[model samples]
Structure formats: structure tokens, C-alpha cells
Target: MQFSGFFSAAMMMIVLSPSLQSFPPAEAIRSSHLDSYIRLPSFQVSTSPDSQDDRFSFRKAFEFRNANECGFADHETTGVCDPTLVHVAITLDVQYLRGSIAAVHSILQHSLCPENVFFHFLVSETDMETLVRSTFPQLKFKVYYFDPEIVRNLISSSVRQALEQPLNYARNYLADLLEPCVRRVIYLDSDLVFVDNISKLWSTNLRSRTIGAPEYCHANFTKYFTNSFWSDDRFSGTFRGRKPCYFNTGVMVIDLVRWRRAGFTRRIE
Candidate 1:
């Protein structure tokens, strides 16, 4: 079941970002109106022409359309902030490109509203957008470059070398990396497939929580920390009044609105 070699080898996550105050009246988010709400400087993706030497290639997937009940007709528009749109984010890297493609294909193949799903790909490498475009053909997606330097020093050695990649930490900065209008996002690891409709997962009611994911309260979470961390009451005692369960960041429903209001990016750092 392992898609790639890393801990908890097979898993999925969805994240939903909630609003801090009142939600916006309009359901649609247009790129033109972003200037008023954009708080972070936009990151750049490489525009170099696709090279023949590029290491990966994928066959074009059949275009999937929305079912009649969905009532979605905005496919002509390229807006990423559409409330009806399901925002799913995944990190893209050459090391796991195969898994990433398979995940996307599975989502599209099983989704009830395939066209309504928008992908927000986070990456440290360049020229991947081109590859994705060629493969999906009619896929709705945008690529955002995650500067490795932003999290380079913050990352430390891990049990697996793949865990050491700076892009592995890109999920922490997603609230800042995505458009301010993207309030909710499903952050997925590029290593799993969806056999059921993703909309079912998207419709999960997070209620007042910032993020939602499968919780394993029975797991020995303490083993994740170091001896010094366990010895220090300041660090260990932070969980004293709470029941923290082991949750995979890979599959999460993140409320970006709640994340931005709480300054989660800075908190994670």
C-alpha cells in the first residue's frame, strides 16, 4: 500500500480553513479583487520553456465533467477562489511525481464534480507546471513556488532522507502561499489514491476546529519527541490539559481563514 518510502507509508489528509470573523457575502472569488485582501508577496514559478531533457512524462487523462446535480457552469472562468470549487493542495517533486500523478488521476476519476476541483500545487522545483498541463490537458490548477530557503534552516534530519527535503515542510506555509481568498484547502501527500468521491471528504463538517483529519489517540505520540523535549515541562506540559492524538498532516481539511487569523505560519516556525 506504500506509494513512496517514508513513515506511515500510506495515508491521505484534507484541510479546511475557516473564517475568523463574518464570511464574505459573495460566494465567488475573482482574481481581479485579490489586491484588496492579499497580505503576502506573490511567489514566482519558473517560465522557462519545457525542456526535452525533463525527467518525467505522463499520458493525457480523459477530461471529466461535473454531474447534473452539481449545477456548476463556471468552467470557462479561471478563478481559483470560487466557493463552489474544491481546493486541494499537494507538493510536487521529481522524487514522487509518479505518486502525485496517480493521486490526481484517482481523484478526477472518482470525483462527482471533477471540473469543480482545483489543484494548488506547491513546489520548490521549476518546469513542473508544464508537465502537469501536458498530462491533465484540461486540468484546473495553479503552481506556486515554495522557496526552499524559507524553510531550509528550520528543517532538521529525519529518520528517512525523503523527510529531510525542505519541500516536506511547505505545508506549514500554505496559508501564506495560497491566495488570501482560498479559505479552505485539502492538503494531501502525493502518495495515495481516492477510490471514493473527494466531495464526500470535502463536505466533512469541521464545525469550529481549524483542521480535520483521522485521529489515532491510541498511538504512542510521546516517542516523536526527543529526551530533552520530554524532560522540559514547558514543552511536555503544553499537552497537559489537552488530549492530542496523532494526525497525519498529509491528509487534512485545513481552514485557511482560521489559519491566517491565528498566524499559523509564524507559529509553526
Candidate 2:
């Protein structure tokens, strides 16, 4: 069952961002008026016109921007975890290290979940060994790795290409190596922590839809994915063609069955 050396592969990417409160009220992010604007993927730092999507901004969609005057780490500072995060896949694909996992624990420590629920992890060769030995010894989940060389081949011809995976590379590709039993999963970024229980969040409904995410109240979402492709058709259908709903990749319930049935992964590619 193991693809082993046949396919290791590579890539990094962007998805969505969340709010900024442990007990995050949607109202806080709503105030950002992000609802009024379709947040496009752009570089965190800008140096040239050609470097707009330079970093994995879109992949960081689940992270929260600090609104507090003093900057540090606060579990509740960003968006709150959904009540049903358990039903989905809580995953982290490690490219390097940024204490994102610590942040994930900050919330999960308090958020409730089924004892059997598992936290999936994907990491690079450099970090994979340490990840299991250091922080995750008995956390109740399976950790897997791929030939760094294969990942390199997917990108170029050397495993060094894997060194550049921006941020959301894991979430964007984790499902590929997942067990067949995992037909659907909710992907959450490590930057987030839950202030409450997530059992109910996983239970969120899909209703044959490919995914279930909070619909945005305003802003033409079509532009978010369109502006880059020169045509809005890429994800013009992400929200069923309705005005973009506030779809946060940090917290989304995806129907893998539909995702596979409709080739959602191919669409995202």
C-alpha cells in the first residue's frame, strides 16, 4: 500500500485565514470588512510588482492577524475553533518550524474531542524525526513521511526543492497519501488553537456539496482566485457561484467523496 519511493513529490501553497480571538466572535473578523473585500493572496512582504503572490499567502488563510496592541502569542487572539473540528482531519504538514504546533496545542488543550480522534502530521525529512521524538510521543495519531527525493522530483530533480514549501503545502496535499478510510477531512492550520469543543464542528453538514465553509457576507470572492488566473473561472464555482461566502480554509469541512467524485483536487490544482 505504500507508494514508497515511487512518489515523494513536492509543493507549498495558500488557502484561507481565520479571525483573531480565542473565543473569536465572527463579529471581530466581520469588522475587518474582509467581508466587504475579497482577500486576495498576496505576499506578506512586497519588493516588486512581479512578487505579489511570492509567498504562500493563500495557504495561510487559516492564520489570524493579531488585533491587540502588544504583539505576542495568545490562543484566543486569532479565530476560534469550530465546535465540530473533530469530524474532519486536523493536520499539519511541516516544512520547517515556527511553533505552529505549540499554538495548535494551545487551543486543542482546551477544546474537547473524542478520545479516538487522531491528529495527522506530515513533515519533511529534516523535521519528521524530531517531530515524533520531541513534541509528539503519545498524542494518539499516525505520522508519515515520503522520500524527500520524490517530493523533489515532483518539483525539480532534487529534494532541495522541498525546502521552499511556503506554508499550506501539507493541507493542500495531505489527502493524497491518506488512508482510504479517510474519504473526507477538515483541514486546519497549526497556527490555530481551539478555545472550545470541536466535536460538533466535524459534524457540520455537506449536503452533497463539495465543501462546507462559512459563506462571506460581501466582497466578490470570484476575484480572489480569478485575478491570478487572468480568468475568474478557476474557483468561480467555489461558492457555488453565489457571492463568496466567508470560506476559511483554516476551518473547512470538505466532502472527500465529492471532492474525488468531482475531481475537486484536480480543480484546485
Candidate 3:
């Protein structure tokens, strides 16, 4: 299960490769969706004074992970994990996007949502709306942006802090500002593209644990977590007590509400 921090930025998908259909440009797609959606320069977290508490539980959320150890052939879910209407949430820092513009456009096209699903893209304030609008305007996905100060609070402030929780940096606000109903949020990076349908990746459960994902538990798995995450008694205890089921964060389906309930975030934070 050699999934590193890079995979978070790389593997936002799980489907197999396409037959190379000539999909329209992302800009064109954005135009189609926004024509119906409220037009805006950028997206930001919306709040309402009338907001009510809508907490979550282990009953509502699930976790999934991607691992190179098993490769594509062995990556299929077992019999217990075959469900429909599964939802997934992915978080990306558009600033981390690299490679050619065409590559980024291609990755956005792979979002495996026919209808009624979420693929959350968390971009920077300085980034232009045109960057994404022109890139992936077709998918009716939600994109949000935060000012530098807010982003500072939402993501790690530095590399040193990031090493403490490589995957945690992008989700800095999960422990704080996440909506009360947000029981689980699957944190995903934007670097990789999907080969298989995302629903296939979302159908599984995490069993009784509040968190579940394929462990990057091998010796190599150590790179993604901060010394703090690796040193936590729960993680270490789980490591020694169980079969070393380390997890890669790329395709994680999390239960934020449950994690908060069990003080799981407090444990890692």
C-alpha cells in the first residue's frame, strides 16, 4: 500500500481508463452547468444566521482508501461493499495543480458523477475563476475559495506542520468550521485521474471504526503521517494490536461527525 502524500494530490479517482472519448473542454462544460446554476466569480463557504445544528454519526459516514500494494486488479471491493447512492467529497488545493493545463482539464473530466454527488474543490483566493470555469465548467460540482487568512486556518501554515499530518493540512478546518451535518469528508488530492467509476470506490464501509481507509501501514506508509499521527497510542496500538492495516488518504471516506464524537480529530489534532 505505497500511497504517499503525493497520492492525495494524484489519486482523486478509482475507475479504469477510458476508450479515449473526445470530451468537450472544461470551459464549455462549466458554461453548461453555470447557465442553470447561480453565476459567480468564485465559490466560498456560505453561512446563514438561520443555520441549525445537524450533527452526524458513524451511522451516516464511510471510509475508502487507495493502495498501490493491491494494484488495479486486486482493488475491487469485496462482497459486503456493494451499494448504490454512495456519495463522496474530495478536497483539492488548486495551487498544488501542476503539469500542463490540458492535463488538469482532463482530470476534471474524469469526475464520475452522472447526477447527485459531490466533488468539492477548495481553491485559493488569488486563483482566477477563469482557471476553473474554462477548465471544468460542465460538471455541476461545487468550488469554494477562501482568503489567505482563512486558508491559513484551514490548511497547514508550513511544511514542518504538514509533515506532522501530511493529509491533514488541506483539511485544517475539519476540526473547527465544518458544518455540523458533515459527518464524513473524503479528502482527495487533484493530481491523479480516475479509471473506474467513483461509486465503486464509495460503496464500501469502514466496519465499526469511525475511520477507515487502506492503511499505508508498511514501513513506507510512515511518510504520509506526521510523527504525531504515527506516535499516537491509538495508531500505534492499532498497529501492534491489529494486522497493521495502514491507510492511504487519497480515496478516504471519512465520518467527521463521528470522528468528532469519538474525539478522533482531537486525537490527531
Candidate 4:
């Protein structure tokens, strides 16, 4: 499976191609019950005295009925070990909460087996969980808190302040954060909205590769490094025998089993 997206300063539109492998027909969730499954909860945020009054606000609920053209595991019986369940991981924070909600809505709207798709949300704050639950009442998801101290020292200064956030590097530790039963997962950025079934991307064959993404070999890779890095043979020689290419980390399919076995998280740090 391949996804193409055009990037610019303002907006980006991504078009994804379907997979060759076909799946069995799915039973659609009745439209009549859609309201019950997606009712947004009314709740109050517990804020400190000094916190802003508008620190947390309500979000409108969204419901998407499956077209029932594809097969899916029974939501009642499908556990984390179920092979049919499509696992997806995403990071959530105050800055991108709105975009994340829209992204989830887009995914459910386009997925053939919306019931079988489970979300693993990585978050730094605990309050976001209540907000997510209220927004998507029937969503099958779990939240994991990422400790900022783990990567505080490893993170280098970046040009953008947002890039310096600890949550930005949470994806690097998915191998450790997720359960052992989860063999693979699709990691998506909060900004993107899926126009096609993500199951196609889930069915992708990684072959011997532990990770798969759109590679950009045409870009000038040297600009990513400092002049001193190129001057030192020790740093520049890391790519000696390989043809390396830059790939966006925002959207990727990662083989967690291979990642764990290889100790990739530690190596990245």
C-alpha cells in the first residue's frame, strides 16, 4: 500500500491506494443505533484556581456508520489478541486535541470495520482521557501516559519550539509502551484525515523490513546535518554501505515485534 500527500506551508491532501488482498464482506452497524454509540458526554473539567476559565470546553460528537462491505471481528469477542483487529497509535496533547478528534472521526468514517479498529493513544497529561471518552462515547481505545523524563536528555534543540516537546518523541518508545500482543500498528499524525479505508494500509506487507513509509531519496539529506558532523568521519561514515532516504515519521506502519527484538528504541536514543 502507498499513500501520496502534497506538503506546503498551509495545507496537505493525502491520497492512499488500496491493497491487493481482499477481505470478507462486513456487517454494517445500523444507522438507527448510531446516535447511541456516538453521544458526546457532558462533563466539567477540574481546573486549578489559577487556570483559565476556558481551559477545557465541550466538543461536538461525530458518528460514522460502516458501509458493511468488508469483514470484521465481533466487537464483543475481539480482544487485543484477535488477529483481525486493526491497531492504530496516535499522540494526543492540548495543542492538537481538536485535530486529533477530527482525525479519529475521519478514520471511523472511512473504515469498513469501524468496530474492530482499536486506538492506542499516547498522552502526557491525564485529563485528556476524560475528554476523549466524552467526545467518542463508544470508541475502543486506551490511553498511555508518556513520562517526559525518559527522553529529556536525549532530545536535541530544534528550530521550532513544538519540536522540542516530549510528546513529539513518544512514537520512538511504542515498542515499550504497547502490549506484547500487538505485533504491528499504524502511527498517524494528528493533522491528517483519512479519506480511504486504513485497513488497506494495515494489510501492507513489510517483508523483511521492520518499518515502512514513503521514502524521499531526492531530498538533499546533507542539510539535516551540521558542517561539523560532515567534517568528522566518525559521524559521516554511519551511512557508508547503505542508500539512505528521508521518510516522514508522521505516518508509518511499524513492526513492534521486530522493534522490540532489535532494541530499536534504545538505539534511537
Candidate 5:
């Protein structure tokens, strides 16, 4: 039942830019039209010189039967704009494609209203839409291409090269990538699978908070920073009067309405 360690361990292997670790606005930053900067190339597994051995293949016929409690028949007829639908966002790449598929399967299997859930997938590769549809023919999903160049300059050196990948920061720009009608969304990491109905998590109330997640106040927050950061009052003093805690970015319920209104993505850059 304890998934904290599992999530933490999995996340350690998948690195993200240090900028994404905390929330603070940079000085005089401007937002760019990410859509115009990066293009999703055609699906070519062999394009990379070393990609010949890195082909990804999944079961072409993986399907999940919905529970009777799930009133799915009507949901199929409903559009994604329908207020009744639950929106879930996840990233898809070669490294985590299998885990992402399994996570989708687990959600559908356990959800009481499987048909009401619509997925918003952030992908950097081409032909991902075709791949996802082939796996789950009945799935309600759409793919958004996240350009790596959008965050390349914002990223700093990390312990692992994987953490510095542009796709890892894609979560930081979900508000800009998804449809504006999707006011709320559950951003899930591709590495984990769920045993419970994801809709339960989707329905959580953020209240006045821009985002909500399990916070670990007991964990040492200072360890995430460096001696130089702590040594300087100008940098360390930012946490004054505020109680900071550790929260895994792997799972979160984000209020995109509040996020966009506040211009959080611009600040993060």
C-alpha cells in the first residue's frame, strides 16, 4: 500500500531540471510560442544512428473490459468538452511507453466510470497517436507535441543526463499545451501504475491552492539545496515565513485555470 518509496526510487532514475524542483519566478522572463519552435518529426525509430537496437514494441491487442458500475455507454457518445469527463495528462516517450500503457490500463480496469476519463498525452515523438490508439482502440485520448527547445536554455546541469532532457519539463507547461476547457487535470508520471480508480484523485478539491499533492513536512527540505544556496541569505531567505515541504512531482492535481491566470509557466522559465 505504501507507494512513496516506489515513486521516489523510480523518480530518482528519471531526472528533471533543478528549476522544476521549486517554484520561483525568474526576473523579466518572456514566454515563447512552444508550438512554433518545435515540430514533431515522423515516427522513425531508426532515424537515430543508435536507435536500431532501441525499437519499442508493445502488445498490439491489449484491451480492458469495463466494470458494470462504470456507466461507460453514454460517455462514449459524450464529447471531451462535456463537464462530466475526467481529464488525465501523462507524457509518452520511448523509455516509459510501456509503463504509460500499463498505467492507462490499470486506471480503466479500476475506475468506476472508465468511459468518462479522457487522457491528454504529452509526447515528443511522432506516430504516438497511432501507437496509443492501436493499443486501446476505445480509449479517449489526444496527443500534444512538447518541444525540447522550449526549455533547453532554462535547464541546468543535473546529476543524471536524463533529468536534463527537455521532455521532463513538459509538465511545467501543461496549462499552455492542453485545451483551455480542461480547467483541471491530474498529471501523472509515466513510470507508475494505479490500483485505485484515478477518478477519485481527479475529483480532489484544490480549494484555493493552485496545485495539490501529498506533502511531506517531516522530510528535510534543506538537503535538496546546496551549501552555497544555504550560505547566502539572499537565496535561502526566500523560504522565510513559509513552511516548505517535499512533494513528489510524479502525481499532482493542477488547477490550470488558476495556473494560467497567475502566469506560472512564464515565471518558471
Candidate 6:
């Protein structure tokens, strides 16, 4: 299904989610119960890196609840597929674990219905899961391992070596990585801190579009490519009849349903 709305920003990526609704009060919801959770199918990994030995420790965040007007909070455990839950995805690796944790904390601190938010963490390492569990004991989240080999051959040299990391491309595969039940998700970079209720942003209507983000229509989009790319119509023809705008992939509202239907992961690979 296509979402409705236009979000304008100089640099941002846009995406989608399920319809919105009022959830029950936060006081009735308890994090201790862990009965049913949707398990993510594992990706085939070709290599085994050394185990994480010195994982960072974080203080558990104060659990935030929904206001009385909010509905859908249940005494039983909330499943990942709950229509009232807001789905958000973020990549986790040793290099950005601290920032990810901080970002999660910031989101919880500012959300009107923190307990209604579900996090889908993408990771290249297996050990980060334990670390995240300890840090956010009450957090409703799941970790999905993304094999680096999936993008190893697809990467080319870049001006900054950090941009070439395999995990950096993890967002491109969200349609393939997350559960089929999860129709839409917000993909976030570790560097952002939210000052407003995320549900406000989550409530965005993408109209008939597959994604939504802050658009930078004024930037010099051509400077992102090499001279040879512009010289060949075969290489640059992809933008033939359209106006290309630069967007910051850091924050995006992605409609996974549309993304999968469009075969975006295969296209990116």
C-alpha cells in the first residue's frame, strides 16, 4: 500500500509505515514478560570474526510510558507485529555501538509512547546483542546479523574509507533483512538525537510514494559522480527524464512493502 505525505528537508531519506492509531496507557504495559517475538531468519555468513571481548556498558534507561489518552497498551507482552507499534531500524557495530545506544536513549526520552516503539537493530557482529540487552533491559528490540560478505564485492573505493564499510550498506537491504510482518520501518543513523516525539515524524503520510525524506533539490548532484560517469549516457541515463536531488540517508521513513516489491535490494547490489 502507498503512504501519503511530503516531508521537505535539505538532506533526508523518506520511507513508510503502517497506519497510525492510539495505543493504550503505558502503565499497563510491562517489559518483563517475553512470550512471543517474531524471529528474524538468519542470513548466510561466510566468515567468523573474533568474539567481542570488551563490550561497552551502558546504564539502563528510565522506562517511559504513553499518556493516558494513548490507547493499545496491554498487560500481556506486545508482539512485534502489533499495528499500534512504531517500527524503527538502526545498524549496530562496534564502531557505532555507543552512538546507537545514545540514539536509542534519546528516542525513548523524547517519545510520547516510548513503550510502543519497536527497534530492529542491524548488526554485522553476533555479540552486540548481549550488550544491547543489558543496556536497554526493557526495550522491545531484535538484532539481525548482516553478513559483510553480502556487500564485500559490491563496494568500490571511496574518498573516505569509513563510507566503504559493509555495514554502511545495511540500510539498503532492510526490505530483505526484516520480517515480512513488518511492512514499514524508520531507518536511522546512530548520529541523531530526537527532541520531539518520534510518533509525530512516524505519523507522516507518504501518499503514493515508496519513501519520504528531506530533499535537497538545490545541491550540485552531478558532483557526486566522476567525469567518466557523466560522459557515458549508459551510466547517467538513469536520471534521463527526472530531477535528481541529494538526500541524507541518515534518517528515512522506508516503506518495506514497496521496497521489496520493487526489488530495491537486488537493484542496489
> Among these predicted structures, which one has the highest lDDT?
1
The C-alpha stretches of model 2 lying farther than 4 A from their native spots are 1-99, 146-167, 217-246
Candidate 4 lDDT over residue span 1-269, tens digit each: 33344321112233222441242111111112222234443654434436545344445566655556655456667566678778999988765654576678878888887877889999988887887787778788899999999988877642234467789899999989988999999998776678778887788798898987765656554655667767778877886767775677878899999999999998999
lDDT of 2: 0.42
Q: Per-residue lDDT for 87-146 in model 1, tens only?
A: 999988765665677789889999988999999999898778877887788999999999
Residue 28 Cα positional deviation in candidate 4, in Å, after optimal superposition:
35
lDDT, candidate 1, residue 53?
32
Best TM-score among the predictions, by candidate number: 4
Native-vs-model 4 lDDT?
0.71
Q: Find the 10 residues in a row with the least total lDDT in model 5.
A: 24-33
Query: Compared with the true structure, what per-residue lDDT tens digits does model 3 show for residues 1-269?
Result: 23355434344433222532354222122112222143333333212225332211111111223334422322123211222223344443322332122223333344344332334555444343445444454433445553345334444332343343333344544534444644556555433355445544454465666655554544444543567766677754645645545465544667666677777545654
lDDT (Cα, tens digit) per residue for candidate 5, span 121-235: 9988876887777667888898999998898888864223446668889999999999888889988877666777776677776778888765555655465566776777987
Candidate 3, residue 103: lDDT: 28
In model 4, residue pairs whose N, Cα or C atoms come closer than 3 Å (at least 3 residues apart or on different chains), thus clashing, are 26-70
Better of 1 and 2 by TM-score: 1
Taking all chains together, each candidate's TM-score versus the true structure is 0.72, 0.48, 0.47, 0.74, 0.71, 0.71
Q: For model 2, what is the error of residue 1's alpha carbon versus the real structure, in angstroms, after optimal superposition?
A: 34
Q: How are the candidates ranked when ordered by lDDT, highest leading?
A: 1, 4, 5, 6, 2, 3
Who is ahead in lDDT, 1 or 3? 1
